[model samples]
Target: MASNIDKYKSDLQKLLKLGQQLYYAMNYEVFEDKFIKNIRTVMNSDEEVTKFIKDLPDFDLKYQPWYSESLVLIKQLLPDRLGDFIKYYEKPKNRKLLESDNYTIEDYLQGNIRNQSFKIATSVGLDAALPQFRQQLSILQSIQARFESSLFDIRQLVQADFFDSELAAAKELLKHKFARAAGAVAGVVLEKHLFQVLCDHHIAIKKNPAINDLNEALKKNSVIDTPQWLFIQRLGAIRNLCSHNKINEPTPEEVGDLIAGVDKTIKTIF
Candidate 1:
């Protein structure tokens, strides 16, 4: 399984290539046929867009023009483009004559409207009605540049030193086949980090919190959504089982899930 960072980098590159293709093709079909088909898979979802932007390295650098421009486009422009294209135009190529209507008397009579429509249409289709293809490509290009610089900011893919002690220790424990202990440590890390999330977001917290308490606080404070909150609630059970009952040993598989879940959860909140 690739880490989230690796997946983010991979998807960013793919979106970049798709943008270049759309730009050169200069046709609505590029968007209708290829770009739309893949963008959702590439970015996962709108929620993940916020995650990707947040996760990018050097996110605060002042000099990356593409990075900042892309941020604005992603948040503001690409969304409307994604929503309505051919459908917004509300007409299909098949409906129109294969050729222009023989330069009809009616067309000559209404020459100004005809001329504008001609500008809107190209050798392709009624692309004049919309230029979402261009908009999509523009945003993809911004995302590409941002990711490129950010990757450099973070250095290599395996930046284990970037992690805090508990997280790093849990990884080392897993490497040494200490699955049960790793599971416990991961639980502690999850709670501590969720606590940190509260502090970072300025959410009110009670003294000496449990996982349930932390998870609920996160949800109530709008730090995490319902689905994520629910998933971590299950992680809370695994943590409790591992920490509270010495005799009820967690399986390696369960511990592995615990580790992965906590890792992703923390990254998302951050």
Candidate 2:
């Protein structure tokens, strides 16, 4: 009896010959219809073909190109049945190819599999990182809320002092100066906190880095140097003005600039 491999090879050759005849001889309509109908009758009579047909993935029953169609039919006939066929006919001939030796087949397969696995892992890692980013954003928002609350309270206190005996007894000329001094001090504190929070979030400079060390690090990670950083710096300056009581009312332009800076920094980091 012929081995399974020999049988498969013979069938494949027959299939190829039929295809060539159809392509070159232009007798495909006649040959394919009659030959395929006869083959189907034979296949239906054979237990092996019955088994093969049962293993195929769902496909239109009327589709032709018999060799490819037969392979799918065989697969559907027996689930995971190809593994046995592969082991018998497709095992690597070179043992060195099975071993991970330099440019061997094993090494190539390993590299391909590793790359596929890494793509899956990277996708999962990005999904996991999103929640952490949201948490960091929430913390920054909380800091902003606290800062605003503190500034409002300071403003109220400064306003109350206008009616205080100390301010009332003072010359009218020094009253404006006193209010400005209070605002300036509040603005400085607010700026300091903004800087501290950014550093805490790892979105700004390291707190204790020496100037030289910082410069060297920046050189290495120069891509991190961004317009967002400049925006944050400008926002801090505006916060400083408010905290220090230099201006009783900050301009809308200053507030908008500060908001834009914070937004840019958040977007870049996350």
Candidate 3:
């Protein structure tokens, strides 16, 4: 009687030979639909097997001869079940192997099918989802970096005794930093609001000049502007003070108020 490993090997071989035939020989369109459906079903039904397959390295089986050999052996063992499928395995090397004894039909068949099924499924899903995932990730990362830098600027302002500085110098630095932070926040919020407006009302703005445009658009769309705009402006100024090493900065309390205001704005907008 075949051992569990042998049975698995046999099943794998049959599937691999079929996938190779479908993918290489017949072109991807021939059995892609059926192959994908069956693989998904098997993955869902067998958690352990799915895990094992997912854990395998992503390169050719030459790196793990035993695993590769087992797959090939499996494929040859199920010729009747996979003969039609082998039409897909039209690659020169694969075709050669199918006709050679370099690897057992059983092992080669099993490994190839299991690996190919996993490869195809993952490739298709990732290809479809990666762009959206990356976009969201980039947005979150930018938000995190902005918040961190804001906190750092606030700390430096307190240490520099900005509150005790001359009024003119302090005000100038304050304005600069405020603009910077406002711009960052505006960039995030405007994009979001504009997209929403376009989707809901079929209204679109081809170009955004500044945060003012976003504010006006929001007002036009019946969305209330958040007080956070003021805070973002303040944060931008604080950022400038630190960047330029300006003398006489705003008080910690004043900066705190700005940050709080911006946070409030974010809460309202989001």
Candidate 4:
């Protein structure tokens, strides 16, 4: 069985190949009369004429788009090109015939519009679709060229988003006067982020490492200098104060500082 990444690559290649084939099929329909003219000399027999006028395969044009999967990957990996990719496939509203008919790639595939003859005649059948599909194919190829690296970046992006949400939740807790709870939430984010950083650097650590443990490992591995190590130690102390020191409640200021420090550490360290 192929992995999702492998499937994604295969789908991209298939899309490009199929897009090219569809382009050729569309052109064959548009210039079919010209094809007959060029092959007139060879039409000596019925067999020759039949061979020469054999229908081109337009079945491939009905390819069910892998849109659901491709769109998700596009949003995550090539977000900048996402709009254009969608634009090429969807029917544009208030479109002019001079610009384009309301017809789109979807219309072409669904048989809602014709590529041949006077019925549903338009110059922008697959011509409009092919150019933009080629652009999308190029975008997919760029991602394929650096797939592993792009995956790593995606992991980092997802983690960063999670960390941001955690911090926001921590802030909401602090606003409700639950300083200890806020610090704990912030502490978890900091700890998880450090763990990820260690894994990224391939540094060995225990299954259940403390914030200080992760911090010390990072410092020992030279991932962070002494100053950063000291800063993290201070942040770790505040986390301990909030988590373990039930006798003394953490101040709002201390929890606020801890959250801010953790936010900075995750962003700067990684």
Candidate 5:
């Protein structure tokens, strides 16, 4: 079985390769004609141009899968770059033709724009997208530069995959009206995540720490700020109601909130 670090390294490399392919695709669309023209004039040889063209790696980008996966990783690891990374991809809601209505890569990928026209060039969005892809690639490269220290990130990513699966199971339970069971499942996820966070911060664990105990430990150690501390405290209360309280049944709505809250906390806190 591949260890978490190896899995993380592989994932990062895959993202980097996909990003490079996407960049190549966009670059080819934008400058292939110019490149061929320049190379033909400079080399004055058809054989050389044919060889160059053949050497270019063939790539057909299924943009959404790469974009979605990279977006999630950027949101987790390098959140400051997330906005710009998204800006180049998501289509604007209100596009003013003469104003700030620049086309996006999404428009090009979705076939919403022309290949060549008198109005706009096929490279309309490449200007924005190429730099963004480079930036995201840089983010991955920097992470790869320091492999050992990134184990924490790898652990978080690995745990995130498990948490997402468990939450999906909880969602299925909720859909069947097993509200208490769903809440219990969500509460367990939250508790397990909190324990993991404690371990991440190297906090000493007590025997059988409850959600409240873990929350308090995190708060007292200044691992979480006041607002986050209070938020976890509220989650602990909801978890208690779901796990221990036996009088009133947990509403689907409340259990839904618990599941959603757990999801957010697990994604954000680490």
Candidate 6:
């Protein structure tokens, strides 16, 4: 699966590629009717956006009213990046720039207005009427960095929730007097949670991590103390004993200890 960063990069790259193409087409004076259609496809929106806005108040207005909503897919797939892109995109545009001679509908109707339009787009958007390329790039970079950190936090939260559910299921098993079952469940949860924490921190571990391997890995990474590591290893042994009847099954008290240890580790460190 592709990461969110990859998708965000793709979206930004697509926009830049389109912008460059448009620039070149205007610069070179491409075909007459086709470039008009190309510009329409690129700039003019045929899609309606206002339907997403619910419960708009009904009122009479003397002046023209404008309303807009962005494409839903853009925000959903590239939520963090696109959201911040939209937010601060026009901040520098609020500043004034030296006014250029205004073009009318007549200017657009005349041939060879592509250069004029391209010049305007390059300097400043028509609506905003100001140009700040450096500031725009800086803001965009800051937004991307923040989006990355926010994605990391979201991963942590999702892992935490999954661990919470697994731990609770193990306790419920124990409540039903399924001591052996509870020990195995708690042990599995412990291993999975530890692996998730490692992933959250971008730590690489061996594939199909074992409990003892995880315990040592956690300690080596300063994720747990030596005593806690040893305790976790013992819990792994309890899980092994519970799994095999050749060794005596773990008692309820032993299983309770397993659950308690897992719970404590989750609460304190996770």
Q: Candidate 3 overall Cα lDDT vs. reference?
A: 0.37
Per-residue lDDT tens digits of candidate 4, residues 15-67? 55655555546555556666566667667876785664454445343434545
Residue 59 error, candidate 1, Å = 30
Clashes of each: 1, 23, 45, 0, 0, 0
Q: Model 2, 1-270: lDDT tens per residue?
A: 453334434554564444343222222222535544555676746666445344433212222344243343233222234343233222255432221121221232223222233234221121222232233223223323433464423332232232232222322312344433333433333333334334433555666643233333433455345553454446556655555444456554554444344433332331
- Among all windows of 10 consecutive residues in model 3, the one with the lowest summed lDDT is 121-130
Model 5 ranges off by over 4 Å: 1-140, 144-154
Candidate 1 local distance difference test against the native: 0.57
- lDDT of residue 248 for candidate 5: 82
lDDT digits (tens) for residues 122-233 of candidate 6: 3322322112222223333443454557454445435556666777788899899888888888888788877866775567899888888877888898967888888888
Cα RMSDs, all models:
15.3, 27.2, 23.4, 15.6, 9.5, 16.8
Per-residue lDDT of model 1, residues 1-270, tens digit only: 465356555656655554454343333232445534454478878787556434433311321343333333343223333333223212334444322332221221122123334355434333332243354445455554655573443322233223345666877887888877888899988887788668766888889999999999999878689999999999999888778878888877787788888877765554
lDDT score, candidate 6: 0.53
Question: TM-scores of all models?
Answer: 0.49, 0.22, 0.22, 0.46, 0.51, 0.42
lDDT of 5: 0.74
Q: Which regions in candidate 4 have their CA more than 4 angstroms from the true location?
A: 1-153
Taken over the whole model, the C-alpha lDDT of each candidate is 0.57, 0.36, 0.37, 0.72, 0.74, 0.53
Residue 170, candidate 2: alpha-carbon lDDT: 25
Stretches of candidate 3 exceeding 4 Å from the true structure: 1-203, 225-251
Query: Which one wins on lDDT?
Result: 5
Error of 2 at 261 (Å): 2.4
Residue 144, model 1, lDDT: 48
Clashes of 2: 23
Residue 39 alpha-carbon offset, candidate 2, angstroms: 28
